[model samples]
Target: MITTFPIVALFILLGLAIPVGLVMALVGMAGLHSIGGWDMVSGIVQSTPLSTAGSYELLTLPMFLLMAEFVLISGVADDLFRAGAAWTGRVRGGLGMATALAGAGFGAICGTSTAAAATLSATTLPAMIKQGYRPDVAAGVVAISGTLSMLIPPSVALIIYGLIAEVNIGKLLVAGIVPAMIVTFTIIATIYVLVLRDPSVAPAGPAVPWAEKFRLLKVTGPVLLLFAFVTGTIYSGIATPTEASALGALAGFGLALSSGKLNLGTFRKALVRATYGTCMIMLIILGATIFGYYFALTQITQDLIIWVQGLGISPWIVMVMIVAFYLVLGCFMDQTAILILTVPVIVPLVVALGFDPIWFGVVMIVTAEVGLLTPPVGLNCFVVSRYSGIPLSEVFKGVLPHILAHLLALALIVGIPEITLWLPSHMN
Candidate 1:
């Protein structure tokens, strides 16, 4: 039944409150059943789960999630935010800048935007609000800043992209560094304008002594070390990305315990959180795998690609359209689901167009980041709204400027692919 056109059922199920994972899985099984009855379905079920679960690349997802869960459970995010606030708090638009900068640091702890936004909102929003920062600015900065993780090392989005596209995972991880830095700078620049236009929105904070500022880094040192440890091993070719993730998770756990921040209960909680998060991610992957199988059986993605190629449109035009599609999809869906669902179809088309996979990955991730800031279903914006009791309308208003800034940055990345590819090119 599903093989006739599983996609219709997919959306129908999605509309009916079916979980995305289960929906994909069901459509896939149904497609197989349509093809060869229960025999085909059973054969695929036996093969798919093991292949999906046993893949080495998939190992990174759980480890990354575990490391982040431990860090959040340990309350390291708070210390990291405080350290950032102390350093950048004194300048015009200081608190906002600090939020962006601090996000870069804490991005290492959480690779997903929602996790970072929630952690940041709980950690920094109250302080920003108390400091006379406008609620919208405070909430917007927290929400938008959460996107830093998309470009940061160990990014979940980048990992999944690399896995699906069969790109070099280590190189993709290295590739994200410069672009992430670029986005961070763009965000800070945006913050400056937002504050300058209305100082009342985010008045300058008190200046701190140089010694005190340096000391503040100490407060965030453990998490930073964990980041450095993971990235260093990956960049220097000392370990595989998989190895680095495991090491990083262990280091995160050790840091939490040694610092007396992780208790037995919290440790258990982190494990539970990590398990749930890992399961959520794995389920999505399982669904995507099944969906991809059904998609391949149909050859629809190939036909579409061939059709686009026949049109002789500039590959760049096609690329832009592909990104636009992502932006539109991002408005209504989670970034992860958007990326996973589209990758099977879109990536092959991108590869056929002669674009570098790593660069396209960065571009798509940036576009997805913009989606996180867009209206109606913007998860990060919703996170800010829930935390601050600000209406989504106001939160979206505050984030609109930043979304424009991200779009500008995305244009730069798309135009000059070097911005996204330079570091990975030189990677060991």
Candidate 2:
């Protein structure tokens, strides 16, 4: 069954001519018939959507997406970039560093990699290039920084992983904090070193006066407030993650309106975009639900777990191998597809190895995040490349350092579980 089902599924994926959601759903249906019968497949199809979507947790998806859209449409990315540039631009290679920091900050509110890359590239890349930053560095920083999407609070990938693993979504979110900050700083430091070695690659921006530096903070102040409110509410037990998402979305809209950035066309576009994002996510969820069931019924999940335990290999090695598999898959698949296809098989393996599911959820998010910067199908690189009109090769070249930073962060989390577990521990 493994040979046949996965083979068929691979061929379907390789076709790459259909919506991934439809492919997963069809594959699941085929697997169901092979194992059970048409009756079981029929039942799962009827019930999967309601089972998957009729959850309070899912409200976070659209709400967080909407909040991000509002900020993007309202010109908040520009403000944040300006503030970051004012503070860091004076240092050699500072613009690239500032772009990474700003991308991380924007990522705090927005959870989608493609969105962060698009927004940051549009707002930051042209300015960096104009300031004499090398196209490679300018494009690379934006590509990598967009990966903050999976590390920051309200990350859509983490939310989906939580739902599938039946772990606490709020706890998983809290766990991402340290890893996210570490990655952002690591990327910044890498940029500093790269530019120092090749001085001509980055030139310094004029120093802003202290007064002007402080003045730029006003542009980003409200954004910080929104981030704090959304994440703070969840940590304090004042609301679930989904509820906080709703509040955050409304706050984002209000912020945009008060800033005079909201218009009929912009507002309409944001809604349309949010709806589209929500639909795409839901379709994947539905597909995963069906596909995951096939694995369970076929005993693939159980047999794989037993075989791994019996191998007498260090569980840590198994865990590392699993993460490595994700890295390879991420090179070709989108973040959503990676989660949907692997979480079912991988979750049981981790739990059987005595690792905390919540920690693994955080780890999975961090691992999947590299997809945004990986080659061939890296979404963030594509988004930035499209926006900056830079060649895809340059964007990929730029992302290499950031990808190393991402791997460093992933290695740290794996070697010391405390980094991911600490925040969730304090929450309880």
Best by TM-score: 2
Candidate 1 versus truth, CA RMSD in Å, comes to: 1.6
- lDDT tens readout by residue for model 1, 1-428: 34457778877787786778888888888886776689877878889989889898788888998898877767777887778888888887787888888788888767878888988888888888888987877888888899998889889999989987789999998888888888999999999998778878988788888888898788777877898778888988888899999998998898778768788888888888889988987898888888788788878789888999999989999988888888888888878877777888888888889999889898888898988888767989988888778788888888888998888888888999988888877778
Candidate 2 lDDT, 86-180, residue by residue in tens: 99999998888888888888888788888888888888899889999889888989888888878789788898898888889899888888888
What's the TM-score of every candidate structure?
Answer: 0.96, 0.97
Report the CA-based lDDT of candidate 2 relative to the real structure: 0.85
Poorly placed runs, candidate 1 (over 4 Å): 1-4
> Please, what is the whole-model Cα lDDT of each candidate in the order they appear?
0.84, 0.85
Question: Against the true structure, whose lDDT is highest?
Answer: 2
Give candidate 2 misplaced runs (Cα > 4 Å). Answer: none
| Per-residue error (Å), model 2, residue 4 | 1.9
Count backbone overlaps in model 2.
0
